[model samples]
Target: MRKLVIAISMLAFTGAAASADPIADRQALMKERGKLVGTLSKVVKGEQAFDAAAVLDALKGLEANAEKFDTEALFPVGSEQGRDTTAAPKIWEDKAGFNAAEDKFLADVKAAVAAPPADVDALKGPFGTIAKDCGACHQTYRIKKG
Candidate 1:
């Protein structure tokens, strides 16, 4: 029993010390973005009350993630192979275009943060634009999982 406990502790420590893979990092970032966007959507659709502080926090999270998307190092070559990544090959094939798309997303998120919507009705336009941009990128750069 003592030997088994020691082995389990070693395993847990190793797992904790392991470095994160880039694809995994990106996937986690995207998941965070999705959660933030989902929360904002609820606010925009009248399902939740429009709180300026919450809206700002969500938008700021999106903006920070958008900027991270611009980092060339984040999408290192061959990073997509081992993981269950949704990233498309074209992201590396046409790196410039991918970067451009990321730049546009960053700009859009920054703009939204700068001039946040006052109410649910007012949020519709800007939120729609952000959603459109996300869809465009996903359509072009993300592969649908089976």
Candidate 2:
């Protein structure tokens, strides 16, 4: 019983500590976001023939990713300093502006999901919009590591 208690406690502690690392969490979130975009980009570029269902699936995944991106929890103060984070100091300096950018990301993703594209041509505009949104945010809020 004592051993079981100790193991459980250790697991709980480690889980909490891991989850509390906002920098790592945010990085993972951003990576997932990028991957979803890549998937959609392939369809947009005609690298993959567009299947309406698959396109919708990727867009839905994007919506889910955006929903999970909580700036407050993911970008906590001081989280930009470690784990090779690229977050710009302006994120903290202009919290409102940063949040507005995040909000726009989520809202645009949701719009894409709500009105999914029916063809590659249709996907192009939404994909372009998403790419632009990402680039704009990176330009304003991310420091290029390279």
Q: What is the lDDT of candidate 2?
A: 0.78
TM-scores vs. true structure, each candidate = 0.83, 0.85
lDDT of 1 by residue, 1-146 (tens): 32443344345333433645677567656776787789889998789999876787777778766765534666888876775788999898988988888888888889988998787777788789889888998999999999
Candidate 2 residue 121 C-alpha distance from true site, Å: 0.5
Worst 10 residues of 1 by lDDT: 1-10
Per-residue alpha-carbon lDDT of model 2 for 1-146, expressed as tens digits?
32443344345434544877888677766776787789888887778899887778777766766776778888888787876889999999999998888888888888887888988898888888888899999999999877
The count of residue-pair clashes in candidate 1 stands at 0
Candidate 2 lDDT score at position 105: 82
Residue 38: error of model 1 in Å? 0.7
What's the distance in Å from true for residue 69, model 2? Answer: 1.0
Residue 4 CA error for candidate 1 (Å)? Answer: 39
